[model samples]
Target: MAIRDAGDQPAAGIYGLSIETEPMEAKLAKALPSGEGWQYEPKWDGFRCIAFRSDSSVDLRAKSGKPLGRYFPEVVALLADLPTPNFVIDGELVIEVEGKLSFDALQMRLHPAESRVRKLSRETPSRFIAFDMLVDTDGMPILDKELAYRRARLEDFRERIEADPAYLTVSPATKNLREADAWLSRSGGDTDGVVCKRIDEPYRPGERAMMKVKRLRTADCVVGGFRYERDSELVGSLLLGLYNDDGLLDHVGFTSAIADIEKPELTARLESLKGGPGFTGKAPGGPSRWTTDRSSDWKPLRPELVVEVKFDQITGCRFRHGTKLLRWRPDKKPSQCDFRQIGL
Candidate 1:
């Protein structure tokens, strides 16, 4: 894919607006923002997509302004078939498997081969959950309009196109804080958390004008291994693992939120039990695009120690990001730390 600079002139699409228009961003908040003008919606855990339909041509752009048309051909075709020929909609591109959203299936669409992408699209078709509209069906840009007016325009646009909830659907939003809290409490398998936006505020492009709170959960995991600091011998991160149904421990994730004052004693304590195989099922991998040279240089442990970790999302049986070290789970046994705790 060709890289486009942020300052470059965006290519024009429907309603004379660029298909690669910068998406509005959200600031991560510890708690949901409460106010009179706040509108809450379920934060879908999928690819942030800005879809544009210009006559027969449809373009799907990622939040980073990268072209996603090749990855999701079914979604492109769905938009092209809409009754409204010219429009720009902001939403998420999600894939569902077994009646639940599977982010791993959505990531599989990023294949380089077109044949493989087409095969996966057939096996696991994706859905476009519409949330916002930048261009109306009348081919007019509504960037300066308030979100309350824009949402009405989006609903009318969806009605004109007669979007099917199975493929193309409008996302539900509410103004009540109680309903928003309920959505956050039931967040899992489908929604990630809750996104609160100002109903009276105009569209602010490429700005953190919205607030988002992610649903966090805790899990007990076995201390499978430990990685040392870049140059020092002190412990840096603790590799976490959980036992599978087959009785083999798999590397789930790691936590590096250790306090500096405890590194000396912790390093010494970890070094004493570093001889056995750490994770019997899946182990840490070598250096990759997201890893350092010392990522694979980890010392295996006896899997006797257990630790509690706080995490947000898990994809393909592994934590999506580095976990937060909560506390030592000395009261919890290594065998008690299994995938069932995470609803595997």
Candidate 2:
């Protein structure tokens, strides 16, 4: 979550677009907007990136305004070699594994070692899926232009430059609501969900001018462990686990959405089941760069309780984010909660 200061701006700039400029964001919605003038695109499962190229200088920036060039050298090289020199684009940085986009592979490219990054780049090369054009090849600013206009220009720009479709691809977009819904229904693997944008409105950087509906799904998980709230004995979060093929319960993720009124009784119930080994394999509280003294403290459970939780995405056999507590499942056995539920 580190933010780069103004001093960190690069010496070379792309048109007038700075690397510190934030990309236009999307607000989450339950469904896509039903009306005309709305364009829908596939919500790619990757990093939101802004790619800039001017002459021989090229830069790749994350949505948080952090530099990403070093981590994706292959993308940088691709942009530097492009026939079109002066241009800025909004895209997603993705890596495909076995024909499906892998967020875990993209995350692995962030290693500090150049040798490790180079090896991953060759083994699993990244792709830039362009969805917006901020600046045209003629140095014409496109931010003030309407989405419809910019999208057309982006298509034309792609053909003019002859950008390598393998590395630099222009994302497909549709105005049909049924098509968008179909994309959402088939959302998995490479596609995360659907993104809806106002075709008549201009690009508003750092603003939630677009809407996104993530493909959410539910799963049954074992209550493998629990963490106490900081400075209090009340239960904080329920650590969720799923049994692998080897019959070992591995910590997939946690859900801290427990209702406050149920904490005292839940805490008591958790304490009673804290005797047996919690997660037999790949347990939580592992050493991580984001780990802290208080965050690492967790109590083990007997793995007898089962709860159904809602999750959006999974990476490396684990939930990419904390899940939402739905309700206890007395009808389902803990052994029934396996990796197959989440398609691991």
Q: How well is each residue in 203-304 modelled by candidate 1, as lDDT tens digits?
A: 877766787776777677999999887778788889999999899999988888899899999999999999978999999875323345244578999988
Q: For model 2, which pairs clash? A: none
> What TM-score would you give candidate 2 relative to the actual structure?
0.65
Q: Name the regions of candidate 2 deviating beyond 4 angstroms.
A: 1-9, 217-344
- For model 1, the superposed segments whose C-alpha errors exceed 4 Å read 1-10, 217-344
lDDT of 1: 0.82
Ten contiguous residues with the weakest lDDT in model 1? 1-10
Tens digits of per-residue lDDT for model 2 on 1-344? 12222224574455667666778877657788898899999999788888877777777788666678888888888887778778889999989899888877887876889899889999999999999999988888799999999999999988887876889899999999999999999997688789899999998987767888867777779999988876788888888999998999999998888888999999999999987799999998743332232345889999889887888878898888778986675434587677764545
lDDT of 2: 0.82
